[model samples]
Target: MNTSSKQDERIARMTFASVYPHYLAKIEKKGRTEAELHQVIEWLTGFDAPKLQQLIEDKVTFESFFREAIINKNVHLITGVICGYRVEEITNPLTQQVRYLDKLVDELAKGKKMEKILRSSL
Candidate 1:
């Protein structure tokens, strides 16, 4: 490989070495076997690790990383010493709940305004 590619490979290797343990911990907690974890790690090491390391070394922020790594893709396999699969299937229900609450507050504010107007008229 070329110099840039070799540097990329080294960064990928280092990143994978750093993140694999965390990934294994998460998967083990979910009752997955070591063999399954290895499979997941292999898949992540295939592409994600190198790309992620490049991004990190490029100093990409967490928000951008999450957006690119998880939001843009339905499935992401992230590996390192912190290996694991990141399924972007989880919804942030709380965001919708907060929006609804905000609308409710607006309606309540309107009601208070009407009450104040009626009281002044009386």
Candidate 2:
């Protein structure tokens, strides 16, 4: 595989539990609450608080985390740049999904209104 695919594979194998702290810290540092982060996550992944906690405790990899997720139907509305990639233009499904989450978190950190960040109208 090429280097990009190799990097994607490594990201897929990474544990959600390991990444959760960084996500949490990112928003928290921006004065966003944990609950807001959870709301955004739930909107994207359809995982509730209890289930999220359970998944974290289980140390599920990103692949497993998404494999088991009931991804939001409106996920297509999640568009924009994240990690230097335009999320809407990403061809890899898993990478797009990961970037969608990243975009939401980034929006929240940037002080976007929750309604807009969640794409509530769309």
Candidate 3:
């Protein structure tokens, strides 16, 4: 598989719940709260705390999470370096969306204000 498809396959089989602990650990290590992480995720995916927890309990994959998500309308305004790639310039749609979430969580861990992290008060 080419790079994009190969990446898709890898992430597609990865479960969101499986990554939850790592996310919590990363932010906690940086002195941030799990609730803030949840807020960032909810903002990006349009999944409330309860629904997010439900999906997590179900062990949904990254592919399934993004597929079922309603990505925010303000997503276009989220532009920044993430894993060395500019979010807006990412060539693959699914990869771009996934990286967007990763970038958001990274920002939260770095203590960026939520207003700026969400890109606006939309």
TM-score, cand. 3: 0.90
User: Deviation in angstroms for 48 in model 1?
Assistant: 16
| Tens-digit per-residue lDDT, 20-48, candidate 2 | 99999999999999899999999999999
Whichever of 2 and 3 has more lDDT, that candidate is 2
Evaluate all candidate structures by whole-model CA lDDT and list the values in order.
0.34, 0.89, 0.86
| Best of the candidates, TM-score | 2
Question: What's the lDDT for candidate 2?
Answer: 0.89
lDDT of 3 by residue, 8-122 (tens): 6886788999988988899999999989998999889999999999999999999899999999989998888887778888877777888888889888899999998988854
Clash totals, every prediction: 12, 0, 0
TM-scores, all models, native as reference:
0.27, 0.94, 0.90
Error of 2 at 106 (Å): 0.6
TM-score of 1: 0.27
Looking at model 3, report the run of 10 residues with the lowest lDDT sum: 1-10
Best by lDDT: 2
Query: Sort by lDDT, best first: what order?
Result: 2, 3, 1
How do the candidates rank by TM-score, highest first? 2, 3, 1
What overall lDDT, based on C-alpha atoms, would model 3 receive against the true structure? Answer: 0.86
What is the C-alpha lDDT profile of model 1 across 26-100, one tens digit per residue?
556655554554433223223254574576476643333333532212122211111121112212322222222
